[model samples]
Target: MTRCDWAENADEVMTHYHDYEWGVPTKDERETFELMTLEMMQAGLSWQTILNKRQNFKAAFADFKVDQVALFDDADVDRLMHDAGIIRNRLKIKDTVYNAQQLVKWHAAGKTMNAYLWAFVDGRPVVNRYQTASEVPAQTALSQQVSKALKKAGFKFMGPTIVQSWLEALGILDDHLAKCTVNHLGKK
Candidate 1:
């Protein structure tokens, strides 16, 4: 069966994610935050690696609840560091907590993380039709702008490359192959 460009292995988890989640536009705050967190965790790594550990990550990060994780203390960091199921990277784990707090801060500023992120795309998904993986961009001007804004908002581990990944995951950019169902170009 055909699938999105990123689902390389075609394993059960990857296939499920590709068909149901990948490139599907999501507006919920919690889901967006979780995808953002996982995308950051995916840095210098494979998506399948992160997908395999997503459950453990949800357990460790309290299901990506910004309210809950923003309150995480040193004890939380120490516990996550030793978790064998997840990536077990100290900096990445720490950034989850930091990013959660930053999300909270942005919330207080009358901005949803979704709102801040979707603003770059002007409140609509940037659909891209690529026949192959090589056609997709690793970074773009949009990602560069979002990366700078995220850093200014006190988020960590959110460079342009990471932001591009987030955009893809959040469906802010619909990077399905040209043949996928949602590939469309409106009157632009």
Candidate 2:
């Protein structure tokens, strides 16, 4: 079973992520928030590093529960800063809190992350048929639009590149390689 090029030579954790969870779509808000937070934390780091620390991130960030994370205050930020288990970047940690707050606001407005995001793609995932690893793009115009929209909505650490990765991680953009076996896994 050939995997996506990026995951083919990866470690066990990444291999598992690629094989099982990478592009599986979910409407569950907590899972969506978790994936988005992980992408935000991965800005300057490798995805493998983030994956290795995922459990720690979950623990530190209230298990990716947006409501719980939205309630994070200075004391919580300080605790996260001191936590060695997660990435511990002050800006990223703060942004995670801010993002949760924004999501909470969105929720109060009777909106959901899944509804807000999937709407951009007309309520369906965009399955790309790239032929090789090199053909995969880091960002797209749609990503830029989403980035701008998210920033306007008070989210931080969510530029186009990060947003694109988040979208892919959320299975909104199915980027599995055309020939990779997992390519069709998401379409189902």
Candidate 3:
């Protein structure tokens, strides 16, 4: 039951995420968008903090349904700001809506979020063999490319570092430590 060093000492929420969700490939567009939004919200926070508030986020953002969140107006923003269960960062909240809008547009244009995102990795995960936490990177060249493309597409709060973490979480970039049990979970 060995996990990544980062999650080894985490609380139940983080431990479960590490064991069952992190690095597990998902083609579902809504789930991918949800994880991407969470990573953006986690820019200056710990993953545990984001995980703890995930349910609140789902509820606040209409379970991260892109079409629904894309329709959120100023009133929705205000409500989210007053919500105690989720992070009340105004910029992050607004950007969540903006990102949803972009996702919806992509979907309408016959380019699903899943296809647009996975295209960066040629529709497969990039598995890395890091022996320790230190060996893992905060960002990579591929992440920079993806971030640049996303920013150009009107996605806010998605810097290279944030995109890298999102990719790892979505299994586009599998960064499980070599000794971790989930190290072999993603594509080779």
Q: List the residue pairs that clash in candidate 3.
A: none
RMSD of 3: 2.0
Q: Write the per-residue lDDT of candidate 3 for residues 1-188, one digit (tens) a residue.
A: 88999898988999888888888888988889899889988989988889999999999989989999999999999999999999899999999999898888888888887888898888998999799999899999999999999899888999999999999988898899988875445532
Global CA lDDT computed for model 3: 0.89
Each model's lDDT: 0.83, 0.89, 0.89
Give one digit per residue, the lDDT tens place, for model 2 in 136-180. 889999899999998888889989999999888888888998877
**Each prediction's number of clashing residue pairs:** 0, 0, 0
What would the per-residue lDDT of candidate 1 be over residues 97-178, giving only the tens digit for each residue? 8888888887888889888788888899998888888888899999999999888878899999999988887889888887
Under the 3 Å rule for N, CA and C atoms, how many clashes does model 2 have?
0
TM-scores vs. true structure, each candidate: 0.92, 0.95, 0.95
In candidate 3, which residue ranges exceed 4 Å CA deviation? 183-188
